[model samples]
Target: MVNHNTQLLSESETTISYANRGLNYGDAVFETLRVSAGKVLFWEDHYFRLMASMRIMRMEIPMTYTPEFLEAEILKTVEAEGQKNKTYRIKLLVWREEGGKYTPTAKDVSFCITTEILENPFYTISGDFYEVELFKDHYVTAGLLSTLKSNNRIINVLGSIYAQENDYANCLLLNDKRQVVEALNGNIFLVNGYKIKTPPLSDGCLNGILRKQIIKILGQVPDYILEEASVSPFELQKADEIFITNTIVGIQPISKYRKKEYGNTVAKELLQKLNVKARLG
Candidate 1:
């Protein structure tokens, strides 16, 4: 069974208003985090991202909700769920309070902390490669909120559903200009010979935390070149290898996209370094 612990500002309220703007108008932002060995990995980065997202939405954050205090709340919930020593997926969702008529009644934010104990003890790179396809029915728009991890996720949801129905592990999403943006659950990377290419933030991809870390990792490697450029479906299919990154999965290699088979040499090497960085940190 999964235990849910929620707190709103200073109060532990179970029920929010029916007119909550988050529920009604999707006026909210969230962060999906990985918690291991009683520590939330990259806590400061995640918190700052959350703060930035809230700021973009113009939500009035509570004065008492400092990073230290919020981290304590997350720890409290993790401990209460008996997952202090285990690995789990933790989500922090902050939403605008109740409102009406496409406008918020209040600018104050109400947040919740939920943790689900994961079956795996640690993040294990998948032995089986992910089979992915391109999703093109709808495109994500490019704008100010494009990079934020907000509640408006209809495009991602549709892409995920398309992947499941078509017997694929994941599907790539395109932007309004038909450029390869990202995958259903993570950011996409294409390996062409010695150069690595991923869509830039301007391509309407979420500024994923893991994506940033991977870019930093590649910068230190002298042999490989990492480029953030506009990529197309044809270019992605012609790549030498494909990989994806996210907070929970770390990095996963794509074994097959359509009929093009890919080798996981690059992904395997990176996963090793990423795990080392995690352990050393």
Candidate 2:
């Protein structure tokens, strides 16, 4: 059940303005942080990213995120929820909740952290071999809003709908230039022998936090190669193994892409190493 505050307090105080940017138009930024052991894992990283996104969007975080208030409020909220010693999902959204014209006159920020059991990425869900469609050149597409994590997620939403409709576990979205950018949700990685490859940031993808950690882990190994090149369908098929990383999904291995089942030991091993890194890092 999605427990949105708006749903529960619909009649309380309608801050209805003629037009607020968030409602008139999708003009806001948001982030999701994972909670573990009563503390948010990579919380600093998530805050930095959220601040970065606000900077890109020319927005400001509320006073609550200031140096003095940030940590205290987060702790209080976690304790209020009785989420200690458990892992949970935390979502922080800041937007122009105040509606006015096409631009933002004022904004409202919202933060909610809830408890839900997320599956461990190393543990693949019990499902048959899944199919992955090779995305054509999508790298050439315009990425005007690439830097900002805006609420306008038509592309991601469309891709996810397609994946679910087509029975593929995930949809590999490509830019206009036909390079493997990422899946609908997670950042894409391929493990061919000892070499690991993911699309470069120039390939028009978010700098996902988990993606950064995986890159950092791969950077330490001499045999582990990280490539930021434009990868095609053929290259993905030739790879020995494939994996995707994101905050929610963590690291996921692709059992099959199209009819090709790329079940490799290296991806599984990398998954194991990533779990340790995530838990201990």
Candidate 3:
């Protein structure tokens, strides 16, 4: 097996402590980044979201953890593994330093960068659609925390397990009100001709970076309008098409939900737009 270590500096190595708040109490925020040719995709957006999450959790952002600084660290970690020329997914973890499980002595934060190899630098729309089902094991609570991707992710963990056990490619999560929130790992979008509907941050959906990008791209189209609203499973089942978006996969089309089948008409166009935008940058 290959050895992978969490890097703190270019030449230094460190390991998480037994008292780390992130380990014991899930007190951390992380960004799953895509790296192609040594450059991070949507770096500024990811950096700002990480900062926002830290502030929301009352953890001080280290002055040295600026976007440019962190980007260099990510590249260093990738190059260390001799994978700088290849595509991969890197996780940037920012956590509160050693502290009591429930209460902390200080708000200081620390970070680590880890990488995983990916097969492709750009998303390739799969010819077959994703299989999905509803996950009712838990309902996400709508609040400030719901909008951030924190370490407390037992809900998604369990949802993923359910999907695998049932042989599903993905599962939909619902908020407490029984409204569709998102997929196990990505944001959900429903297409109906010229309109698109997705759960809003107010509906307990994470403010995913790709979700923002998709909405921005759709807004630029004169004939399309993307609306963030509360969605129900019934509405999802009735949509003309359904797709999920995440950093790794720009757009994943859903083929079947229950007895209804969906087509990829809109997903194809959006995927093209996303790829073009990514390449132009």
Candidate 4:
């Protein structure tokens, strides 16, 4: 089931127009949310981020779109799918109304909510070996627009194909300046000793929800120092640990990058704290 502009419909009945702007021009912004026990984890952050992304894309914010209203709609869709009591992954997509080429015919927007069940209710570290390689074929332009979760992801799509062809679990994307921006799917963090480094939003990494949570968690701890700085490719070989973060995975520790292998000491510690925060919320 899916919610199209607050109207619940089965997958077969939910029909998007042939000329839908989102499908035609990639003019859309979306938020991926994790819900557990019928509550959205980090709801406030996700809501604000969605609003911000819509604003950045110049999409009109409907008068009816409010924190409470959107949250209710999301939960309604989840319940309709019979996932009200189960852990689920929900995607809320907002797109401009059909009609336009490069310029939109109207600023008015439409939204859809969809859900899928997740295997775990809380975040857990995977014991499987995960490896990544650099995708140097393209570069993410460093700017504010790159930080938005809009539907401009050709680089990510290409990088995923490259990773698969090369037998790597994932690929690290670089900005025009040759600095490691992030992994294809999420934000990247490098841990060296007690210091942790993640690229700032200015470096073109997605303003990830889990990245913010991890930063807040690290700030409260006296042992580790967190830095919102650029990550160089050279640092990858020297880092003691590397972890990728997103709404779905929470924290995925990268096991290998070429011949260099990483440990999950910090990643494990942070995941425990993250789960605690999620439960408390």
**Which candidate comes out best when scored by lDDT?**
4
lDDT of 4 by residue, 1-281 (tens): 79999899999897878988888988999999999999999999999999999988888899899999999999998888764789999999999998778888887899999998999999999899999999999999999999999888999999999999989999999999999999999999999998999999998899999999999999999999999999999999999999999999999999999999999999999999999999998
TM-score per candidate, in order?
0.93, 0.82, 0.94, 0.98
> Model 1: how far is 188 from its true place, Å?
0.9
How well is each residue in 155-264 modelled by candidate 2, as lDDT tens digits? 77776677777787887877776777787777888887777888877777776888888888788768778887777767877887887877766667788876567875
lDDT of 1 at 278: 66
**Which tens-of-lDDT digit does each residue in 1-281 have in candidate 3?**
11122333432444457888889888889999898987788888998999899889999877877777888778877887775789888888888888665888866787777778899888778987578999998999987898898988999999999999998988999999999999988998999989999998998899999999899899888888888889988897789999999999888999988888899989898888888887766
lDDT for position 70 in model 3: 82
Clashes of each: 0, 18, 0, 0
lDDT of 1 by residue, 64-138 (tens): 778998888788777876547888788888888775567667767777877777776555678875799889999
Candidate 1 residue pairs in backbone clash: none
Q: What is the lDDT of residue 76 in candidate 1?
A: 78
Stretches of candidate 3 off by over 4 Å are: 1-14
lDDT of 4 at 244: 98
**Clash pairs for candidate 3:** none
For TM-score, candidate 3 versus 4, the one ahead is 4
Clashing pairs in 4: none
Q: Which candidate has the top score in TM-score?
A: 4
